[model samples]
Target: MANPAGEAARPTILRTPLGRVRGSGSAKSGTHHWWMQRVTSIALLPLTIWFIVALATSAGMTHAEAVAWIGHPFNAVLLLALIGLTFHHAAAGLQVVLEDYAKPEWVKITSVLAVKAVCTLLALAAALAVIRLAV
Candidate 1:
């Protein structure tokens, strides 16, 4: 359709994640979030494989033996990395889900905050456990 001047109508641009209908676009932080999720996933791959293999090899390790294994610098460091990346990735992914589906704006914001807080606390606890074991 043409306006009063007989010019063609403007093409409709794609809506953003929040469904904005104007020139408004990403808040500029999405790229960082996207990059972090990608980076964490890539880093988690090797860490997860190492963890699984290490666990498989030590299948029957007793409590003390497991503790001793964690006491090793190599094992402790890898375990810490695994915990950190896993939780970081988890929070990022959950935030995306919340942003996409949560109906109420306040609810979405609150849920995201809670998810991040819980993930952060869990990650810290896991790291602390690893450090305690290593000590």
Candidate 2:
């Protein structure tokens, strides 16, 4: 109803003090994403070092010797972990980049999806290759 000598009153929806203060609050996923990124980065460090060392030491090995090296249980497991962590870390980083730099809404979403899909496919391929070698 219109107020006397004024425009109609606006309706008010009730909201808690916290909700008013914080707006809609966080998306609730930022912390989890941040933690995952950090964890993957930490995991990648040692795995990267091990990979470098393995590559360097294996440089002169014959093809059969290299395959045999990967067939070792410890090496196989570490290689798998390295593959997974590396791709995860890369995807996380790319996600952040796309979120920050991709302009249009569609572009950002598409970029993120593409990055995730590519990373997942690459990780799976690497894991399968390693498993094939190990077995």
Candidate 3:
């Protein structure tokens, strides 16, 4: 649609409880992250629900039985994938939180990176453990 004469599109500024803020271009990087996070979240949703159901249905089993259930190829693979996706999502969220709150530049940078590293390691360790247990 074209604007009427003498009328121009005004920038949409968001008004929040904290204050009024304007949405600006994410500098490209932010848009990429936002997109990836949403994609991963969509993928994780089903996996999470599956995990819950799998656990619920097998809850009465013994420790060995539980282990065996997870040892199945499909279950093991999905579990590892879920762990990885979960960690990635968590890292992204934590980075945003840190960036929003951390005032000191050095502290913000270090904390965000540190949290990312930890989450990555934890995800890798979990995946490896699942693979080992399954195979």
* Top candidate (TM-score): 1
Sort by lDDT, top down from the best: 1, 2, 3
**Residue-wise lDDT of candidate 1 within 79-126, one digit each (tens)?**
999999999999999999999999799999999999999999999999
Model 3 misplaced stretches (Cα beyond 4 Å): 1-30
* lDDT of the structure predicted as candidate 2: 0.91
- My TM-score estimates for the predictions, one after another, are 0.80, 0.77, 0.75
Error of 3 at 39 (Å): 0.3
What are the RMSD figures for all models against the true structure?
Answer: 5.3, 7.7, 8.5
56-120 in candidate 2: lDDT tens per residue? 87678888898888888899999999999999999999999999999899999999999999999
lDDT preference between candidates 1 and 2, better one: 1
Note the residue pairs that clash in candidate 1: none
Q: Where is the poorest 10-residue window by lDDT in model 2?
A: 21-30
Indicate whether candidate 1 or candidate 3 has the larger lDDT: 1
Best model per lDDT: 1
